[model samples]
Target: MKKSITILFCVLLSIPSFAQKTEIIVIGNIHQPVPNYNSDTILTILKSIKPDFLLQEIDSSFFNDDFTFKNPPKENEGLASVQYIHNNPKTKMRPFDFEGRNEYRKINGFNPTEGLAIKLLDSLYKKNKLTKSEAAIYKKYNDLLEPLKIAASKDAKSFNNSSNDKICEERQYYQYHKLLSIMQERSEFSNTYYTKANGEKISYLKGFQLASEFWDLRNQTMAKNILHIAEENPGKRIVVLTGFMHRYFIVRELQKQTENNTNIIIREFYN
Candidate 1:
């Protein structure tokens, strides 16, 4: 029995240790009438990279929804986009699958447009019926965002570059994340998330404080997701397409996971 146990132990020890391998690529601002050149450029780049998996910033839940609905025409544009890509012979040459980072899921929850946060906020307001002050505050928040909304509606490119546009959108993004962070911190619900700062809370009473905290936290979450994915998929190459600001964070996270090993490659696609 002792001899047999020793042999089994040796075999188990020799089974080869696994190390996850992944590559992270960042794509910045790919919207517009910049002609087909930009898309073609991206197509060429993707072809050369030939990544096994293609993770987008889009919410995975949405992707699952598209899959469930058999690519319904109106409800989901992303699915159509994916189908378009996959059907093309030249660009669709690889067996890439769609996945999303934690950031995408988290943001999807917060989006004031057709997301959980807006629904909850509406419910809460309706339940309490919102005191005049509370209603006023909410209205103010909406009003603050109106200018950017109009700008975005008129000319997307101009709005994308406008300082107010960034502030307004980032404000919404931060608030959304902060709300999630608060929920997570409070440990009340599962879908509601807190920011990366672990125990931080977002108090609705204090207009934008929570959002500011959570915005930074989103950066951390993005980094964590990138690193976690890389570590979990040892020896397999994975690619992530996220916001440009996240590129450095993902690279740093990967470096830490690899123990400063220089084997990991990093590239940026932007102006």
Candidate 2:
């Protein structure tokens, strides 16, 4: 009878572990204040969530020994997160951005390719040389972005919803995947060369490919960091504060982990 009671007690003790789920909220945030969404808006959202952990979109290397930003940006969501942590002393703030990201961008000359691609596209458009299909794709991409741009200018909540997330994903699809496809179809765009800082002449297509890879890798690393924290904490609530553009990628990656039986429940701030 004593053995039976001991077994029952052990089962009771383990019930909470099985019953509790790790809740994760991914918030799409703006770096600078818009018409309605400012630092106060971000701070309010953080307080409402009351998260046990706040995963900020800041590289770990950027933090000083005292947990403040060594070289802070003019204005960003991370600053608001610091404010939240100050008020809620129990909530832990962590940096989930990819380390050495700046170094990678500098070494790879990531910005030149995109700038050149846009210039080529603009030249094509101005000269009426763009194929009908290419023009249509660009128009659709811009149209999709218009709503986001409008929402960002006025309504903070509208800009951060699932609708906007889907729009952003579509925008990325056209911008990265579809645009690359178009660029590769024409030798004019693909074969164009840009001189890197290191004096190496790389094709525009290759440079864009490298930039896309880096973007994906950075998001993957950030998602992995969030997942690790969720697994370690088990039932704790974690809020991921990231730029609106990165929300889709991080959420997609986290969803993949959920499919593999990770005990995480992803939620939006509104939900």
Candidate 3:
């Protein structure tokens, strides 16, 4: 009888350990105008293990954007879309937005975070590694960005009587160079190919290069602030929503941290 009792006690002690295992779940999906999280196979997968946090690819602006919910269907709404779900205590889910131009600008810099892609590629350009095709691509990028630069420069001048240092660095590096190099380093991949006004084919490297630049820093400082919040809320589960591409990079990097064995859960959606 004593032997049986001892076995039962050991089983009871092990139950909590099994329950406490830190989980790192990664999800991937495409962006849809109307998010499809409800019908996703991952719904059952996620419901089985309720997380403490939900990380999103979006900037924190959503919290204050005051945008009305325009959900696709009743059953497939997110905590953010489903007004009632966000208010539930049993789920204990909280929204965590990344810093950016849209909102939290004072802390994270620009919104759309996509803006960083240009600066990152410009850094490579300053290194004399950008090719002729890449140079043309840069021109297009500039064209797409001219309006933003004008606005940012104006804002910086008004705010500090000078351009932002970070903004200036990007401008200097991206300024036209006399000679351009063409090497297929991961930094110079093409995104869209188009002929220039001169009828020469542009490398379309800007988009891919910008994306590479983002991935290079995603683990470094881009996600640093978010990680801090995650660390502060110990024992709290989190869900981070973010660009589909970034989902993979963020999860992999978190797994590398030594200070805490954080159990990450990743879910990707296409909308």
Candidate 4:
């Protein structure tokens, strides 16, 4: 028994830590104009990198073996990358994004569009369904976001030096991360998502709370999924291609995780 135990211990010690052995690179992607960055450029870059697995931002629940119900279409950056991999007979590609089915599942069935939700709430306030205070608070919270939204819209409209035209990760980070940070700092807006109205608590933040939670839960899930996959397949190279908007949260969370898990090396695509 002692001899057998010693052999098992030796095997265990020979195995390397997950972090020290694996390479995880997170790349930001552009969505519109299918070939804007130009598919050839994207493909060439990916070919050289040669990732073992490509983790995408898209939800996987939409795809089938037939590829008939493709979620975003092949022109989208994420799908375009997939198309490139398929053309290469030598490359082995595995899909990591499940079409956000996980995010959809985590939401507990509350499906409300951001614009629609806000519009409905505004109408409710108009109809007196919401108290004056609730309406006023809601307005105040949204008012804070108006400036950022306007700035983003204006930046996009210019069609010049707009990250929207390209992944342009650095520019996107510097410009938008602060807005998201501000949103996070104002915890007051989330104080009571819904208040009691006629014995039923109504969500005062309306869809705002749901949307915030959705992104948070989604980012957290993505991080957990990446870590879990890495641990299961030690030394595997994984590249996560997500929309630039998610870069701030995903990178932040992944870096924090690395403090405890020193074995894996997390690298930015730019680096």
Q: Which candidate has the top score in TM-score?
A: 2
Q: What does candidate 3's lDDT look like per residue over 1-271, in tens digits?
A: 9999999888876774333433333343333433323324335434544655544444444444443233332322253323333444344333334345333321232222234434556776678666667767666546644543444333212211123323333442343221122324443334434443445444434433333444345434535645665656544555444433344345546656533553433222220
Local accuracy by lDDT, each model: 0.44, 0.81, 0.42, 0.55
Model 4 alpha-carbon miss at residue 134, Å: 14
Instruction: Write the residue-wise lDDT of candidate 1 on 1-271 in tens digits.
Output: 9999999888866653323334555433333324422444445555556654445544435445333323342312233235445744232111112234345434433322224444555565567665565555555555666665454344223333335435555456534553444434322244344342334433332223333454556655665665555555444445554433344444455556666745444444221
**Alpha carbon lDDT of residue 232, candidate 1?**
53
For model 3, the local distance difference test gives 0.42
> Worst ten-residue run, lDDT, model 4?
155-164
Task: Return model 3's CA RMSD, one decimal.
Answer: 15.3
Q: TM-score order of candidates, best first?
A: 2, 4, 1, 3
lDDT of 1 at 43: 50
C-alpha RMSD in Å of predicted model 2 compared with the true structure: 2.7
> Which ranges in model 4 have alpha carbons more than 4 Å from their true place?
1-20, 34-38, 63-72, 87-113, 117-204
lDDT of 2 by residue, 106-158 (tens): 67876677768867876776788879998887778668878778767765577
Candidate 3: which stretches are off by over 4 Å? 1-24, 33-42, 65-88, 92-98, 101-212, 218-222, 259-271
Per-model TM-score versus the true fold: 0.42, 0.88, 0.42, 0.57
User: Cα miss at 114, model 4 (Å)?
Assistant: 1.9
Minimal lDDT window, size 10, model 1? 89-98
lDDT of 4 by residue, 1-271 (tens): 9999999888877776522368887765544543234445456657767776666665545556643236545644565566666765444434455345545533532333334345655665578766555656555555554443333343222222223323333333322343233333444333434423234443324345455556667777788777777777677777776655565567677878877775687875545
